[model samples]
Target: MLTITDLSLQRGGVWLLQAVSLTVQPGQRVAIVGANGAGKSSLFQLLLGQLTPEQGSVALPGGCRIAHMAQEVKASDRSARDFVLDGDLDLRRMEAELADAEARGDDHAQARIHGELDIHEAWSASRRAETLLRGLGFSDYDIGRPVSAFSGGWRIRLNLAQALMRPSDLLLLDEPTNHLDLDACLWLENWLRRYPGTLLFISHDRDFMDRGATHLVHFDQQKLELYTGNYTAFEGQRSERLAQQQAGFERQQARIAEIQRFIDRFKAKATKARQAQSRVKALERMERIAPAHIDSPFSFEFPLSEKVSNPLLSIRNGQAGHGTAPILTGINLTLLPGSRIGLLGPNGAGKSTLMDGLRGEKTLLAGDRTCGEHLAIGYFAQHQLESLDLDASPFLHLQRLSPKASEQSIRNFLGGFDFHGDEALSAIRSFSGGEKARVALAIIAWQRPNLLLLDEPTNHLDLEMRQALTMALQNFEGAIVVVSHDRHLLRNTVDEFWLVNDGRVQEYEGDLEDYERWLADRRKDDTEAPRNNQVTSNGVPAEASAGEGVGESADDRKARKRAEAALRQKLSPYRKRQTGLEKEMDGLQQTLQTLEADLANPALYDADGQARLKELLGKQAEAKSRMEDIEAEWLEVSETVESLEAELAG
Candidate 1:
């Protein structure tokens, strides 16, 4: 449980929060949302005790353990798994005590420490850390790698894994999905749903918030408003509220004008002077209602290219990779004037490789890539942000791109990205990540390219800018291929999906939901077997054999069948447990749905219904906690079943 009373915070003499108060009950997942520099992260800092509020108080239950994902990780030679395991301070402390006891030859203390470790289930700590890392897109090989070996983005993922590893009753995550791919994002959603604690996170990902958040804490006008439902529900409620506010504002304005007109018309007459003075006091006492304001600062569309080609780009029999060895082979792709494709695959797959090959950055080893005579490409990627000139303004950046373009036209274009006047001309060295990303996008948009290749273009963008980009992409009259974790953007912008996996590129004949299921099945299969290329003992390709018993003796085949049957018998209990957990989860989900519907009634939020509201909230939290337990049990049992199946097959 967490509570803030009359919280007021200021930074650089600017108020970020003014008289904001919120109470978050235990087992509630809250999504903190606002524009950039709107105090979302500042609130997190206040909770973490990194910053003190100028006034008011923040309270947490006594001795409650808190865990938060760090935005940065210091470079070190410690193994990644070790770094994650270190998050469990209790386990680490116990280990240290055990070592000391052993050095002193105190058998009694050593035995006591061993018992404590067993009670804490500390034996499985390493495996748990590994699971967290794998869910965040790290390969098994990466577990033993040093922290210093990972890039900045991967290090951020390491921080997330470390945060997840800690045992706590409160978890805080800020932009946890920023560095993750689609697979990792889905995995994290499931993980967070099963976190039986108070969850407070800030994310610009709409889909993520909808799936994970049970409550939304909105920051607007230096005030915090708590909504009892997910982002979609919050949107509906906010729309109604804004509409009512606007209407009230209009009515109030009309009444004030009427009062003022009467006062002006009668102020000179001696007989009506007293009445006019009374009207003036009434006008001054009237509380002015502020009009509702909701408008995005960004508005821009991709300009059409001057020249057009039927087939803008084509690649035939392409083999793309880092060096001599190819990661993706037999890739035949063609892009036309209106082609729009989204790439889908697991992490470390060939999606980026394919993008590089299509963009002509990676030379095809065994095939030819052809381009139209008038081909023009606009490519956007995270690394491109680093390529920007930090010393130059956004206007200057565009001007350098088109040396002959007029300054007025460039400024007008920059205005669409919310870079106005002095800000447009200021050097970008001190700009935030989102600002730099916008400048990169502005340059790409100004090129008027016929083809666009974007890879994770919305990494640092806020929700408003992401919506703007989605709108722009919808109206673009050019071929586009994008690789992004933002499902909303992919679903809205791309017309087709291409799957790049296992050294092959092919069209995926399914929607995003179907692709999600496909990924789940693939992960299940991967857990049953190694991902390395399958080969026989003699180094022959496994798939090259046509018959089932081509190289097996009758005794060996019978033995294998017997072993499989025994393994199935051994796995029956785990399968049963898994089934029971799933059933319990389904029942809890139904209960939660009913409770949410009941809570949606506007009457429950009124002044006379406080008791019922609190009661329903408590029930909701209880049901969610139960669901979390069931899901965790199900995951453990499912993993056991898969492992047994793998052993039987072997």
Candidate 2:
């Protein structure tokens, strides 16, 4: 068991935790959740003995082995596999002793060491390390690469693998999914589920928290509150408690108001003077309950484009790659107004390539690319943050984009993203990763583009900011194509998913759950394939024979092309209708969400607010009914489209 008692911690003269207490039992997976700078990482540092608390005690089991995933890894020339294997300190120690014994020509010591190695199963250490690497999205070829060969993101993944390589009684992971793609995130989730140790992780990924967390440690108001379930359960329970607290606060206020009124009316009268004094004393002695405050600091929306064209962008027979080598080929895609697409694939399967192709970044090695006259693209990627002017303030960043815009307007917009006062005018060089990401997003939103291509936009964002982004995306009228590992964002924001796999891009017919199962099947197939058959980034065998139509006759090829065009013509109306229905449903859902939020206001239950409440309730019901009708139509249209596509394939 891990225990913390009276943990009062302060940093830079600011209290992060005050009298925080938590007890975690063995093998419990606890997810620590809070806003950035809420001391979630500080608590981890305390547990790791890197920081001393101002006043507190932390207890761990005697001789407990702790494994922590480092936030950064120093560049090294060491091979990736060797670096991971080094995580197992005991295994390395045993091997070192055996080597020393062998060098000393001590036969008895060598034999004893060999027996210990056998008992420890040290022979399989390399294989186990390789397994960890593979599960974390490293290819067989990458296993032998030097640690310095990988980029910053991939290096973080290696660190995660190293952490997993170590045997531990307690494991600490901070934002483990931040650098991982969806497939690797799923793999890590599965690994954590089977880990026979106490797990304490800090993550903003909701789906990951739901899947792996058996409990939650919430940091709020300088206190750590433990909940006995997953993140979803914590949300539900917290909502209930907040509602109750709000009600109690309202009641207490009403009672206090009544007492104040009594004191005002009877304080001059001798008969009631004693009673008024007693009542004043009672009011002062009454413990006040703080009103529930759950508002997110970040609140912003993508500005609507003044002009948008149908089929804002299109690529025909496109081959996206670097220089002359294609990473993704045979790509045909169209982005229309109101289009919302989420790209799904394994790491390095060219999701970013496709995004770049759409962004007109010279990634198209072959084929025709066209953009509408009114098409305005707002492209956001991780590298964009690096391109930001580090010395400029957020205010300066926006002002540079629009020289004519007034300072007040820019400040107002920045305020929506929680950048206010001095922070807005401060140089971005001192900002954290999350703050920089917010700036990048703010820049994109300031442009008011008709189309958005966001790749991993939520990387360093906290949960509240992520929720804000999701809401903004939902309300956005422009087209969006995003590549993100955040399933919650993908599910709530995108109407369709595109699978960028096997060197081709196609619409994914199922939801995120089905995509997960597809990945599992692909991983299983990869494992079962022959060792000598190297797999490409798209999971295709590198030595595969030939293209499907390699030997086709000219006439047959022409006929096939004609048939494909005919099928597309036939499917066009259904596809358009499906898209239209999805847009309608999205609008109605937004309306319903607005109504729900209004209804959730505490004032809505008051006597004076009954009329407004009734109106909101009616609006909610009507929107929900419209949503149901649209959903039914959407299902029918989707099924018809699927049937037509299946018929064409057959």
Q: What tens-digit string does per-residue lDDT give for candidate 2 at 1-650? A: 99999889999999999988889999799999987898999998988999999998999988678899998998898889889988888789988997798799886676566545544546456767788888888986687678999999999999998888887888999999999988899988888887878899999998899999999999998999999998877876775676565655675475456445534543555643444454455345332311222456877899977988888999999999887779998888888887788899988799998888888887889988999999998988888899999999999999999999999999999999999999999999999999999999999899999999999999999988987787678678899899998987776566678899988899887778888899888774224211112234674444432333578898997787567556655664686588678657756765776787678788989999999999998888888888889999999999998887787555
TM-score of 2: 0.74
Q: Residue 206, candidate 2: how far off, in angstroms?
A: 0.6
Clashing pairs in 2: none
> What local distance difference test score does each model get?
0.81, 0.81
Q: After superposition, how far is residue 563 of candidate 2 from its true place, in Å?
A: 72
CA deviation > 4 Å runs, candidate 2 = 244-293, 525-650
Q: What is the lDDT of residue 281 in candidate 1?
A: 52
Candidate 1 lDDT, tens digit per residue, 449-546?
Answer: 99999999899999879877976786788899999999878765666789988889898877777888887886631232111122456744444334
TM-score of each: 0.74, 0.74
- Which 10-residue window in model 1 sums to the lowest lDDT? 525-534
